[model samples]
Target: MNPLTRFLSELQEVSLLIWRAFISIFSYPRYYAETIKQMDLIGVGSLPIVLLTGFFTGGVLVLQVFPTLQYYSIQNEAGNSVATSLIRELGPVLSALMVSGRIGAAISAELGSMVVSQQIDAMRALGTDPIRRLVLPRIFSLVVMLPLLTVACDILGLIGGGVVASSIYNQDYHVFATSVRVGISTSDLVSGLIKPLFFGLIIGAVACHKGLSTTGGTAGVGRSTTDAVVIASIWVIIFDFFLSKALQYLLDLGQL
Candidate 1:
């Protein structure tokens, strides 16, 4: 097949998978146990890395921006800049990226393994819909967990930035905290939270699609895992841009 044809074919398959998962979500026999298990795996299991990423990102932002602000005698605004950036963009984007690397790869590998081993087919033969039994739990878990993770990232990022600002720039911690609180608005918070929902959907859908479509053998599993991370990360970034624009427009309309 030509590259465009292949791309279009893959896109259609992914869309159908997403739609099936969506429909299955409202059906009977909801997999609450599996969903909870996935939540723990994708959310609690990911806490440490998310916290570390948020901390370092905030610290690095302050480290890079503080000197410039200091030189301009506007160092006090550092908190505003850090907080605004984190709440508006960095928190959701970085959290999603981190989760995509961790959860996305794992999902792909596990499902790919099941596919190769025929366990997925076995489940289907035993009268289970794999989309409901497997994909729904993951998709639901991601949707629930990602926003919570983003909140954690936003909070930790601000704290990290404040610590760095106070320690390195000799700024008051109280002032930094106050500036952060003042800098972030309701719209910013909402946008940050909203972005993660779409991101989680993208990650779960792409990972599941790659896993279910795996060919070859163990090598195919590895390829699917790698593709899941790369593709999900790229789509997260692409969607983030459009989501941000659409959200900003909606928020602007709300003020009118």
Candidate 2:
């Protein structure tokens, strides 16, 4: 197929996969054990990297922007700027990107391996719906976990920025905290919190779809894993922009 046709086909497949996962949840088919396992693997296992990424990102941002703010004699508002940026954008975007790289690659590789080895086919033969057994749990786990991870990341990012602002810039920590507290509004939280839900669904859908479609052999598994991460990362960024715009519009209308 041509590139355009291939792209459309892949998009349809991803939408169907997401649809199945969502519909499967309403069946009350509990995959509690699998879901919990995924939550632990994708959420708990990802904290260290997420925390580190947030800390350095916020700190570096402060380092870069502090001079500009200081030049304007409004260095005290550095916390406000940093907090707004982190909560409204960096926290969710960075956290999703990190988790996508880690979780997305792993999911694709694992399911691709299953396909190559015919384990998934065997499950089908045994009357198992892989959508329920595999995809639903992953989708649900990601939807729940990404928001929590984003919140944690935002908090750590603020702390890291606070540290840099207080020590390197000689800004008082209490003052920084107060500024951050005042700067973050309900709209910021709503905008930030909502992005992760779509991001998680998109990541899970992309990764799972890629895995289930793997061809060749081990080489194909590698390709699928790489594709899953890159595509999921791209989708996360693309959606983030639109979500930001939509959220801002709704907030401006006082609807959210």
Candidate lDDT (C-alpha), each: 0.92, 0.92
Tell me the tens digit of each residue's lDDT in model 2 across 84-198.
Answer: 8999899999999999999999999999999999999999999889999999999888989999999999999999999999889888999889888888898889888999999
Clashes per candidate, residues 3 or more apart or on different chains: 0, 0
lDDT of prediction 1: 0.92
Per-model TM-score on C-alpha atoms:
0.97, 0.97
> For model 1, how does the per-residue alpha-carbon lDDT over 1-256 read when each residue is reduced to its tens digit?
9999998998999999999999996778898899999999999999999999999899999999999988998888898899888988999999999999999999999999999999999999999999999999998899999999999998899889988998888899988888887787888888888999999999999999999999999999999999999999999999988898899898751241
Name the top lDDT candidate.
1
Error of 1 at 182 (Å): 0.9
Return the lDDT, model 2, position 92.
95
Query: Which ranges in model 2 have alpha carbons more than 4 Å from their true place?
Result: 253-256
- Model 2, residue 183: displacement in angstroms? 0.5
